[model samples]
Target: MSVISDNNDFSFKKNERLYHRNEIQELFKKGSSFYLYPFKVIYIADPFEAKVNPQQILISVPKRKFKKAPDRNFIKRQVREAYRQHKILIDPEKLNRNLRIAYIYTSDKKMPSDVLTKKLKKTLERLHQEFTV
Candidate 1:
């Protein structure tokens, strides 16, 4: 067990990432989702099998929205960093099954990193409130 402090000492490990192609497809195909402006979040609670981590997250930047690879990669970094900072808000022990979450970039224009960070926080908070209920 780990205790998350009110500090900036957080890490995003390999286990916490969503990687498998099939899993990503499943998440997109059947997961419940919502949009927060430039971001569209899709999540599935209690995935049938136990995974290596309690939560697995994937961030996607559509090529249509970001024509350049550099732009897409930059946005991906921003999303990952935001999630890493606020992940402490979610406690793994409280949930019985794995939570698979995917963040899809949906806008044509780019927004400031601060705005993305704020929206990511709101997205995570909404996820927490959603499952806790």
Candidate 2:
């Protein structure tokens, strides 16, 4: 794991968010996936080619599982927060590729923030292992 020397490294910036419709579709079509309890993580590592960020991510809480807008929003917030805190676990320099990742909330019920964070941290650590290999 690479050390995050500056506090600014923790910020989740706008460019780090993956929101383009085509890119999202392509991710679902081509990315590899794994289920980690509450989340279904899908990811693609593309050759580096002038990407704005080494890593970009999408977070989704399906409306079918979480009918209310607020519930979906809250879950998304928690997932994003957890990912933001632990993202450094995946070292971009080691991977040498741009990664596009999606964290799809798979659980039917809401999880406590602490539990969610722990799960996400484990998920990220697993991803790091995969990418490095």
Candidate 3:
């Protein structure tokens, strides 16, 4: 992950989250994906005429895999926290276009927070390499 000198750069604001239904559907329908253990990452790069955050992300923990609401919520929280901390790894300026990404939790078992953070770091690193190329 790339280091940011300013601490405020780490915040995960509402605008940085991908939550609209239409956007979610488009990302899943048209995006390319890769699996990295617990996360199935789908992403697309598209230019937008209107100014927007360079990247926005959606995180999902399936109901089928996690039968209870709390379990699903817990995983989502972990994923979101990890993303918020490590997002600086991807430099938005270099992307030069809007990037939409979805992270679907695929593992049936809940992962420890430390392991989840490590995996998320690797996932973001991979994404950084993919876009920077």
Candidate 4:
């Protein structure tokens, strides 16, 4: 297991601040977002000078698709753990600019964890690359 210290702690725990629903809703309304699939990652960045940290990330696997709460929770857990373990995607080096990101899963079914990890890694890499540019 890897320790995600410093800028790599993706858990967004109590010590790390986060954005609120109203803010997200407002961003959604404004639509300054980006999407990469296996999911649609909706991000609303402050069009300002720079950002020291990612405000927050929300993961969604639609309840309408999974239907079973437990199943949905399981997938959500997997996604969060993956992000927690590998948050270089949200690295502050990249955050020399500002951003607020939301990950919304559009898939309609559950896949194994291994498969999910691979996809997540790809998405994170893409986000990292995009973040810098």
Candidate 5:
């Protein structure tokens, strides 16, 4: 199979792709954004300016609601899987363009894995369209 066909072959070059606390806090002061969705997915996509890499795309679940590591971890894993599956849909050429996307779970409860997967795909589709537009 061609390399592109292998999702595992995609190079997520760095572990620091996700913004650190200081970076997110600093983004509020320095960076501006184009609205992608309803909820404010506050992000600093600057680090991606250097290369066509997915420096980090964060998906945060609420802490107050889950109140347990297992629940949070499960939801995080589901989110990561959904991203992994759909990420290749977005081109590497365009990767650096929309680099820092922070997809926060604004909902109240932890949705089922299937439900989250569906929502994630829909959101990614919208992002692809908007990014290309």
Candidate 6:
């Protein structure tokens, strides 16, 4: 697919991350969202920035559910890795717009990497399908 990068490096770079406070607020307040078990995806499509990638994502692990800092960090790390591996499931060109997505882990316990990856794949596919229209 044209959207698949040849690099295959699968590195999650700074540009691919959602960091702005305004953007994050807008995403949760106005974006369309859905939940799939451990993840709740909130996304909004905006005009593409001149040199930015087609998507910027955020991963949130609530401290309320995972009180320990280590637990939260570990879950966030797993989510990031999963997204890094399967991100191309969404065709960038088809979007015609830049997507800002937030994947929030709602579960109170840790999940296996394999299961997390599978769920993330499905989540990405679902995001693609939702925005493709």
CA shift of 40, model 3, Å: 0.2
Q: Rank the candidates by lDDT, best first.
A: 2, 3, 6, 1, 4, 5
**How would you encode candidate 1's per-residue C-alpha lDDT over 1-133 as one tens digit per residue?**
9886634458888988999999999999999999888789999887435445788899999998778999999999998999998887766556555789999989887879899889999998988888788
* Model 3 C-alpha lDDT versus the unseen true structure: 0.88
lDDT of each: 0.85, 0.89, 0.88, 0.67, 0.61, 0.87
lDDT of 6: 0.87
Off by over 4 Å in 2: 1-8
Clashing pairs in 6: none
58, model 6: CA deviation in Å?
Answer: 0.7
Clash tally for model 2: 0
Answer with 4 or 5, whichever has the higher TM-score.
Answer: 4
Task: Please provide, for model 6 over 1-133, each residue's C-alpha lDDT reduced to its tens digit, 9 standing for 90 to 100.
Answer: 3575555658789989999999889998999989998898899888766576778999999988988999999999999999999987775655677888999999888999999999999999898887776
State TM-scores per candidate: 0.86, 0.90, 0.89, 0.76, 0.69, 0.89
In model 1, which residue pairs have backbone atoms overlapping below 3 Å? none
Top candidate, metric lDDT: 2
Which pairs clash inside model 2? none
Stretches off by above 4 angstroms in model 3 are 1-8, 48-50
Number of the top TM-score candidate: 2
Superposed model 1: Cα runs more than 4 Å off: 1-9, 47-51
Query: Which 10-residue window in model 4 sums to the lowest lDDT?
Result: 9-18
lDDT, residue 4, candidate 6: 50
Worst 10 residues of 5 by lDDT: 31-40
What is the clash count for each candidate, in the order shown?
A: 0, 0, 0, 0, 1, 0
User: Which regions in candidate 5 have their CA more than 4 angstroms from the true location?
Assistant: 1-16, 26-40, 43-52, 95-98
Please report the TM-score between candidate 4 and the true structure. 0.76
